[model samples]
Target: MTRLLFAALLAAIPLTAPAAPSDPYPSTYAPVPSPPVLIRNATVLTGSGERLDNADVLMQDGKIAAVGAGLTAPANAQVIDGTGRWVTPGIIDVHSHLGVYPSPGVNAHNDGNEMTSPTTPEVWAEHSITPQDPGFGTALAGGVTTMQLLPGSANLIGGRGVTVRNVYANTYQGMKFPGAPWGVKMACGENPKRVYGGKGSAPSTRMGNVAGYRADFIAAQDYMRAWDKYNAGDKKGDPPSRDLAKETLMGVLKGEILVHIHCYRADEMAIMLDLAKEFGFRISAFHHGVEAYKIADRLAAEGVCGALWADWWGFKMESLDGIQENIALVDRPEKGCAIVHSDSSEGIQRLNQEAAKVMGNARRVNIDIPPERAIRWLTQNPARALGIGDRTGTLAPGKMADVVLWNGTPFSVYAKAEKVFMDGALMYDRGDKSRQPVSDFMLGQEAAP
Candidate 1:
C-alpha cells in the first residue's frame, strides 16, 4: 500500500515542462553604493573576537565599507551618533519557529508542525509563513536581524526551512533572505515516534522512526537520479517529471540545502550522525541538543554545531537530563561546538541574557568562555549554520549592514536593543521609541503599548 501511494505521487509530477531561463545576474546581485552611513564613537564587537573601543564603522552601499577609529564620514552621509553604545552584528537564531508557529496565539496560525505523518519532506516552511505575523517586530526589537524559520519536529522528515530577514514586508518573498539556502528540518527519537504512533502510523517506535527516514532518503536518492537524467537531456522515453516534494529532497542530496536535525538524546544524536555518514550528507547543526555535551568531541570533529538552550530542561521526558552546562561543555576550546538558540518567542528577545547565563555557569565550573567567543553562539556561528555568513554574520567589509547597537552590556540582563540597522537603514531606535514597528493586528488594541 505504501509503495502504491509513493508510485502514485511520483506519477503526478510533470515530466516535460519547458525549463525556465536562468538569470545571469540574480535579484540579489546589487551594485555597491558609496558611503551612505557612518556610526561613530562606539564599542564594536566584530563577531570575530576583535573588539574596537571608541571606533567608527562606515557603511557604503548596504555593506560594511570600513571599520576603524578616526574614520571620516563621507560628505552627505547619514551619521549615527553611537556614543557610549556597543555595536554588534545582528543576532541570528538558527532554530526558530516564529512565523510558522506565529502568534495572536491561535491554533490556526500554528503551521510549524505537520504531525499527520512521520515523513513530510514535501512541506516548505516559507509557504506556511505569515510575514506580517507581528513576531517579526518582536524579533527586531530583540536585535534579531536574520532568522531561520524551521518546521517543527513532529515528523522524521518535517520540511524545508526558510531563512528570512526580520523586516516589515507585504510578502514573504520581500522578507526572504536572498541567497540563503533552505534547510531540511529532520528529527529523531521521541518526536517522530510519538507524533506518528499516536496516529497509528508505521513509525510508532524508534526503529520505525529510523526506517521512515531511510525510506524517504532512498526515495529522494532515486528522485535525484531521475532528475539528473532529465537534466542531461536524456528524454528518449517519457522522462520522470518534476515533483516539488522530491525536488526539495533532491536539493538536500545535491548539497544545495542544509539539514538541521532536532535530537535530544546522545545515543540518538550518535545514530543520526552515523545516518548522515551513511547518507553522505552533513548534519549542519543539532537543534535543542541538551545532551550535546556528552558527544561534544564527535560533533566538533564532524564540524556539526550544537544549538541549545542556556538553562532550559526538565519540561519533558527527553529533556529531563538537560543541564545548563550543555552550552559550556560543547563550547570547550578543545571541542569548539556550541550555539545558543531560542526556540521560544520570549527566549528570542533575550538570547543575549541566555548566553550570559551560560557563560556565567561555565565560569563557575572553571570553563572560561570569553564574551567574544560566546557572542558567536548568537552571531557568526549561526550565520555559518544558515549559510548566510558571507552576507550578514560579521561587520566585515562587503557584508550587509545588519547591525545592532545596545544600550548597555549586551550580555547584561539590563541591556536593551537601542538601535538596529539593516542594509544601512535605521529600522529601530529606542530613544525615539515611537519608531518601533506595531503590527496591524496590534494597532488600536488597548494592551499594544
Candidate 2:
C-alpha cells in the first residue's frame, strides 16, 4: 500500500522549467523587432571589405535574410528606395563613457571611477549607468548601434566594462548588448601611478603598477585553484570564500572575459603585453593607443587591437608622442586591427568624420585606402574587439539587422546618417523626427538637432 501511494504521488507531480544558472547580474535586454524591410538601389559598403553598387538588402524576422541585387521582399515588407544613398553596417564604438559619466556633467554625475582602491574589479560600470542620459540619442542619431561603456582610468583595474546597444531604454540592463563578453578596464602608465602615488599607496610608481597587477593576479590564480578543487570533489569543504574582485580576474585568466587596457606609449603597451603573458591572460585591445604605430607589427602578430583616436593628442605627457597619422600608420601593417574610438561625447557624434580624417592623412602619405576598408575600422574591427563580430558588423545573411542609410558617401565631409536601423527597427530617421528616440530628459527641451 505504501509503494502504491508513492507511485501515485509521483505520477501526479507537475513538471516545471529548469532554472538558469545563478548569474548575480543578468541582462534584461528585450529587443523589439520591426517589420521586414527591403532596401534597394543603394551603394552598399559591407564592413567585412566588400562594396556593392545598386544592391538590395532584405531584413526579415530581425536578421539579414538576403543580400544581393534583384532581391524580392514580402508583400508587407517596407521597401525603402535607397537611390543616391549609402548603406553599411552600424557603427560600433569599442570605448565610450555615455551612461557612467552622463550628460549635464555635474558633481552628482561623476560616478565613473572607484578611486578608493587601485584594484577594483568588484565594481561594475553597469551599476553606474544612467539610462536617462540624453547622450544615447546623440549616438543613435550618429548611427552608432552599439558601444562599450567603460569605467574611468583613475585606477589600476577600474571594473568590468559593459557593451550596450545605443537604443533609448528605461534601464541599463535593457541597453546591454546580449551575449557580448564583459571587458575588464585596466590602466597602464600615468593614470594609475599618478592617482595612487599622491595618496602614498603601494603602486605609486611605474614598477609598483606592475607589482600591484602581479599580486592581484596571483591571488586570483590561488582563488581559481581553490574553486576548481572544490568543484572536482577532490577537496570537500565550504566553497572557497568568494572575492568579487578575484572572480572577475579569474574570468580574464580563463579567457571568458576580455581585457581592455588604457595605454598610450608603445613601451608601456609592450610592458603590459609582457605582464599579460606572465599572468596567462590575453589583452584584447589597447584603448587610447596614441603611439601604437611604433609597435604596430607586434600588436598585429598577437592579434591585439589598437583602439585609437584619429588625431586628438598631446594634452598629456604620455600622449606626447602621438601623431596625427597614428590610425593610418597602425593600419598599414599586415593583420593590424585598428579602430577609431571616441572617448569624448562630442567626438562620438562624428566617428565617421574621424575616420575620414585618417583616410585623408593617409592619402597625403600616398597610402591607398578605400571606403570599404576604412569602414571596417568603424564597424567590423570594433565588433571583433567587443566579441560581437559573428552577430553584427556586417550586412550579411544570418546577422543582426543593424545598418545605416547615409545621405551621401560616408567618407564625404557632408555625409549624414539619414536612417539608422537596429534589429530592422527604424531607430533614427532624419526625415521624420518621430522616428528618432526622445529620452525622458529631453521631453521639455528642444529636439535633438
Candidate 2 lDDT over residue span 1-449, tens digit each: 12233223324433221222434566655445468999999999989889999999999887889888999989899999999999999999999999899988998999999999999998999999998888888888888999999999998899999899887666786677877889999998999999989898768888998888889999999999989989999668788888999999999999988999999999999999999999999999999999999999899999999999999889999999998788887785468899999998878888999999999988988987899899999999999999989999999899989999999898877989999988887778888867767667777787479
Minimal lDDT window, size 10, model 2 = 1-10
lDDT per residue for candidate 1 within 249-358, as digits (tens), equals 78887888999999998989999989888878888999998899899998888899998999988888888889888998887575476888998887898899999999
TM-score of 2: 0.94
- Output the lDDT of residue 283, model 2: 94
Runs with alpha carbons beyond 4 Å of true place in candidate 2: 1-22, 332-334, 447-449
TM-score of 1: 0.90
Highest-scoring model, TM-score: 2
